[model samples]
Target: MSDGDEPAVTGEEVRNVADLARVDLNDEEVETFAEQFEAVLADFETLDEVPEIESEPDLVNVMRADEVEAGLTQEEALSNASETEDGYFKGPRVS
Candidate 1:
């Protein structure tokens, strides 16, 4: 296909992308991917042709009110802990 106003996808770009992904593609596969990538870019250009949307939809928060809730205390939470130190659960230190 002839090159358009936008730069055409290149086999080198396809190969580079494949290499970054650790994909092993032959020369023919690279050419195929380049064509496919070019088609995707061409399709994306269609977005520019879409008419601007004028209407705006009403937006509102749909969440419950935040409120204080009862929870287990330090002693109660530590009860299930195999190791506790300074009124809290002690875990193995990770370097």
Candidate 2:
């Protein structure tokens, strides 16, 4: 809301929001919260006065290209396993 204008929000509106959020607010608290909401909205009006930047955003490829690589052999892969069965790592059994 602009300066000198009535608040866009009212006590009834604030109470509705509080109810939706499951918040408990007395009548005085609702009025206070309504005023705070109006002030916050008024503060946001200042952002409209900010100048917009006129430039294309610079974008870059941050990731390296994928390359083919050699992987570990079966024996190397299984060398450190605490337990193995056939050609696979064996994990603890679950019920």
How does candidate 1 fare on TM-score?
A: 0.55
Estimate, for each residue in 1-95, the C-alpha lDDT of model 1 and write its tens digit. Answer: 33566448888899889999999999999988998998888788887789998887887879998999999887898998999898988999999
lDDT of 2 by residue, 1-95 (tens): 64456667889999999999999999899999998998887788778778898988888889999999999999999999999999899999998
Kindly report which residue pairs in candidate 1 clash with one another. Answer: none
Q: Candidate 1: which stretches are off by over 4 Å?
A: 1-7, 60-95
Alpha-carbon error at 47 in model 1, in Å? 1.1
On the 0 to 100 scale, the lDDT of residue 55 in model 2 is 88
Q: Model-by-model lDDT, in order?
A: 0.86, 0.89
**How many clashes in each candidate?**
0, 0
- Each model's TM-score, in the order given? 0.55, 0.70
Error of 1 at 75 (Å): 18
Clashing pairs in model 2, backbone N/Cα/C closer than 3 A: none
Worst 10 residues of 2 by lDDT: 1-10
